[model samples]
Target: MQIALTKKLAEAVGVKAAFAQENENPLFSWTANWTKVWDNRRTEDMIVLVNNATRFTVAIYQVKKKDLKNLEVMMKKAISNTLLFMNINPEIVEEYMRLAGDVELVQNRGRQTAAWVSKAGLECSFYVGREYNGIEKMFCDTVGSLINYNHVNITKTRDEGFAPYQEMINALTELTGKPAYKYRAFELSATLNLDVYKAVRRIIVPANLSFERLHNVLQTVFNWKNYHLYDFAIHQGDKYDPAIRVVPNRECLEYDENAVLMEGHTLSEFLPEYKHILYTYDMGDNWEHEIELAQVIEDYDKESPFLVEAIGQTPPEDVGGVGGYVNFREIMLDPRNPEYKEMKEWARFWTPELSDWEKRPRVIRL
Candidate 1:
């Protein structure tokens, strides 16, 4: 795997004067490395800067060199994660990202080993000890997972849905006696209300996830992409208040004056306040998910979010909402129906993976 360090960190590690330039540069040479190459980042994978160190680890990244074309974006994301790990405000992180590499950073006590993000958007842990071999092991283990596969940075698992960067937050916990940021784990039951299909999913998510990401997790649960505008809101006495809605970034949207946006305010604060939230996606189709807070895990230390239960098939995106989907299901139930072939063909356009649309309802437990 290829790793290019900032000139300063390369110096701190004495990598500058180590091997002769004409000789073997094992740090950048995939063949000279002793560790097993689980994935490949043969060219350039990461731009890492770690002034933070603990008895356990040093901050490092494992970028998937092939998936992404832009290393600068990965670099900026790593820097933002580092700055955020140091308890810098989200707004300030954005400013730092805007400034880009012009900003010089220093090591902070907050992050004993700082932050890193792979091109696959994965955070890493480089375990170490006081012994010489321990440091060597850390380097080898960190680099070994750089093969073409996602041995290090995987966002989704078979059951665990959207994995948060909990490792980054808890990197300093053992040394400092607490995580860099406190996250509350929430057990949520999301039921998509349709005219016929009652799709349900039980999820466990960290509250620190932004509204935008929470929307994404819901999208995954329903097998729908974020193709339309969506928002999270609580029910008022008569109507759901737009004033209390949490939408995407204001810069990206023509936002309401009163709607809460991501970053400046994240789900960390708003999610715990209410037991029920209405997640509405596709304003035209108007698909509503009633999210009921089933349980709360205080001082949660789990590595990622997951889906514990799933039931019923979800209609594909833009199926004309409740009424249209009901008609589609009716047609599919009878093979002799004239619209059966045409309707199933159309559903395949939205869900390419499903072998048969006329099959039984979807059910999952994990």
Candidate 2:
């Protein structure tokens, strides 16, 4: 019965059933992790159920509209406990919760109850039923209603419209106290080498895009799987300051140990003025690319990043680097070569689109 209920809950939330866990005790207990997807972010959700011969208790840990200060001190502790149980940092959990208000807890007393409306609109009311199937249906229906309510609310908020570009422009204008030039589009050319035969991609991305997002765009443009370490070297004047390099916070081997993270800094922060930069991917192969800011378009649409043009195929992964790639290409082009057939078979999965250069708009949304 517990397993069936667990399956039902997981299915209703569109999460894998494998995430649900059951514990055999005096009272059967079950817990599961779920996700709530919104326009800008995804939030973690948790559900716990305890049932015995006579009583049942259900708890939901999800984003709510009430602030932490508004919730009782006991409820704050409950929120902390829930975070600890989920192996999430309570501080981070609390911070996000504060932005959305906080996690809500609802409890009711009864053997049989019915659905009702709360101040927050439609809400699930727990009811303990004699038949296990009846309890399962009631729980599923109630939670389903809550999920639908939240989804509708979030969608409504998105539909109401928020102009991020306009907001950014306004903020900059206010800060500078002058009319600021808004760069809607950024034209960038990424080339593995300046030699005759080299892999190159010309992309146009929204100026507000973060460096991390730009990295993803480059990965897609080159048709290379992101399976290696990478960093952006930003030179100031004549010096290469390690502190200014953009690197992944996690697994970053920085010489200065104080390198800035690439997650939050946007392309607009260091482009146009700083036309040339170095992007290196894969520490072992040391595949380096020259990223040059070609032009900043004022009238271009500010939607998302996309590939404007591409040339030359991205070398097969683990093909040793530029020198090895040159050798492999030479052999593959000459079918008479001894290693031709073997190399051809190895390169069978190479993406042809990466080699073709064309003007394509809206290739990717982000």
Candidate 3:
């Protein structure tokens, strides 16, 4: 093992020097899929396991001698920074950080402390385990097993199915003291739609996570693809088959099985063409004319008041975004702006346009 790392270290130094200099000093010595070595006068190989795809196994090295106490502090900072970049939860990161002060330097038997000077110097190795059990395992075994056995419909009856999101929300609320109304529930409901969310929530949250706790977990794990928005993804053919199908809410109202279209179908499969069903929105001529026209409505002194009501309320600091008052001011003050115009278009596209009389100060009832 030591011989292999020595050879790999030579190769790594060669590669590093080639990048910008013919014989520049190597910053660190490492091997791919094996031990990393530190070299000065003597050499020490630090073995590391890199099989966990989601994390990096860091091998620290030094050319000069150092005491264990000083080394521990350096290792702690290095561990904290590395974990932060890997996007591990701050709480989990903190747990690992506490272990930093415990790292000890293995020393030779009968060697005096000062006599134990390292020619190759001090070495530290850390293996960062995967946070969410590697991608393949979670998808294939955990989620796959869920789909294989319970099926999507099971999401409704199973107590485990809907509980995680609630638990996470509850925990975050207790920790942050944020109000229920402060959260962006539309996003949370969207997260509950994914299978991975339930699995991770089980690991992170208490048995009964409140709304705030759920929000924090979502904020932490939003980068994972399983929690990505949209029910159907590019690779849903095998995974989302009815054999393993589950709805977002277990109580989800079913559409006519015959009326519902599956993976490969186009927009025509669901909606009629008269609805001007564009899979994506159009951008074309009179686009500027469309803008000028909206400005006219704003100038007439109509629609602005009710627009205020439709926006609901401002998002809290925890739920930062353009909310009711800000959006209303932006739209009314400059209705012709492209962004506000796009917002208006989306309102019409996603929901029906309210009639002048129908426009209430509060969100219009469905």
Candidate 4:
């Protein structure tokens, strides 16, 4: 969906003929981070994004007609403006923008890979504390569509002396230090609630185990593919209201207040205070697992996580939920069932052993 700049606002932005042209002409030097889009007191015609630190308008798009081509042009303009504002080389930024617009070339390149198009270029390096894929996300959200894998390759070099990015990297490094959490180990039990049936796995994790690590651990134990968003809810009693949400990224922040970032927050920070927690995965599917302390093991000197016990097979991916899985099991068990052949072909996922310490511990990590 394209958000066109109204005639009045475009004039205020000091552009007279940009809308009619096949390109963008910026009369005002847009210094604000267009990615930091906020919707605080929005009108039908306009959207206001605020920069708290500077306390100023970032970008205000006045709505009118919706058109994809116009939006793409706006994005091209925004990308260049932001890069210029960041003190990046205007020529380099222009070149990157041009390359990024080439849909075929970008699609041929990596969607998510370590071997980047350019180093220091396409760097997940910080820009006003931007996280991984920050630029891509901003563009997608603004355009109300997914423009992934078509990201502009920011070729800003380390030689440019990006001090703020360097500082951010240093701070994040400090946060990732081992034994950062206030414990040696934890005895946590995760029980997958499948309505009529409950599949549980008890494991011992390192003190500094992050929500992200725990997410992986649970995925391994339950045989999930880790393809969806997940959140850990630390709540007190029967009600989940006012729960402390620990999520994978900023996208989840919109759903909860004062939510904790999973990367830095660890088990030690909450396990003691809140013995019981909820691990909710696949926001759409809503797979809710109850995670609780099985035994207090603050003194256990375990360097790596270990799965001591388990129950039930890995539920089929997107098998709808308990009802869906039960229906699947019923169909798969009966050889005479009409869908048996098709089900068998589809059900190739590894069904974890009831108790396989030898196999599980090898796969688990700190």
TM-score top scorer: 1
Please identify which of the two predictions, 3 or 4, would achieve the higher TM-score against the true structure: 4
Per-residue C-alpha lDDT of model 4 across residues 232-274, encoded as one tens digit per residue: 8887754266368788888778877599888668888986777
Candidate 4 steric clashes: 0
**Model 3 Cα lDDT, one tens digit per residue, 1-366:** 001122233343332222222132111111121232322325433322110111123333331232222433444444454333322344544543443235322211222211211211121221112222222211111111111112111335675343222332243334444332211111011112111112111111221223222333333222221222112221112322222221222222253232222323332222221121111001111000000001111112111111221211111121112233245445544667867776665444222222343233331100
Assess the local accuracy of residue 162 in candidate 1 as a C-alpha lDDT between 0 and 100. Answer: 20
- lDDT, candidate 1, at 5: 39
List candidate 1 stretches off by more than 4 Å. Answer: 1-149, 152-183, 236-239, 251-255, 349-366
Off by over 4 Å in 3: 1-56, 61-69, 99-101, 105-366
After best superposition, candidate 1 residue 294: deviation in angstroms?
A: 1.3
Q: lDDT by residue for model 2 over 1-366, one digit each (tens)?
A: 222123323344343433222232212221222222222334323233322221122244343323212323323344344333222223444443354243222222222221111211122222111112221212121222112212222235666543322332343334345333323678888888724377788887777767877787787776668889888887543324422678866458446466777765987888766777678888888788878888988656333466767777777777888888778878877889999889889988654334223334445532
Of candidates 4 and 1, the better by lDDT? 4
Model 4: weakest 10-residue lDDT segment is 103-112
The RMSD of every model to the true structure, in order and in angstroms, is 13.2, 16.0, 24.4, 15.1
Indicate the TM-score of model 2.
0.51
lDDT of 4: 0.50
After superposing candidate 2, which stretches have Cα over 4 Å from the reference?
1-183, 194-196, 236-243, 351-362
Ranking by TM-score: 1, 2, 4, 3
**TM-score of every candidate:** 0.54, 0.51, 0.18, 0.49
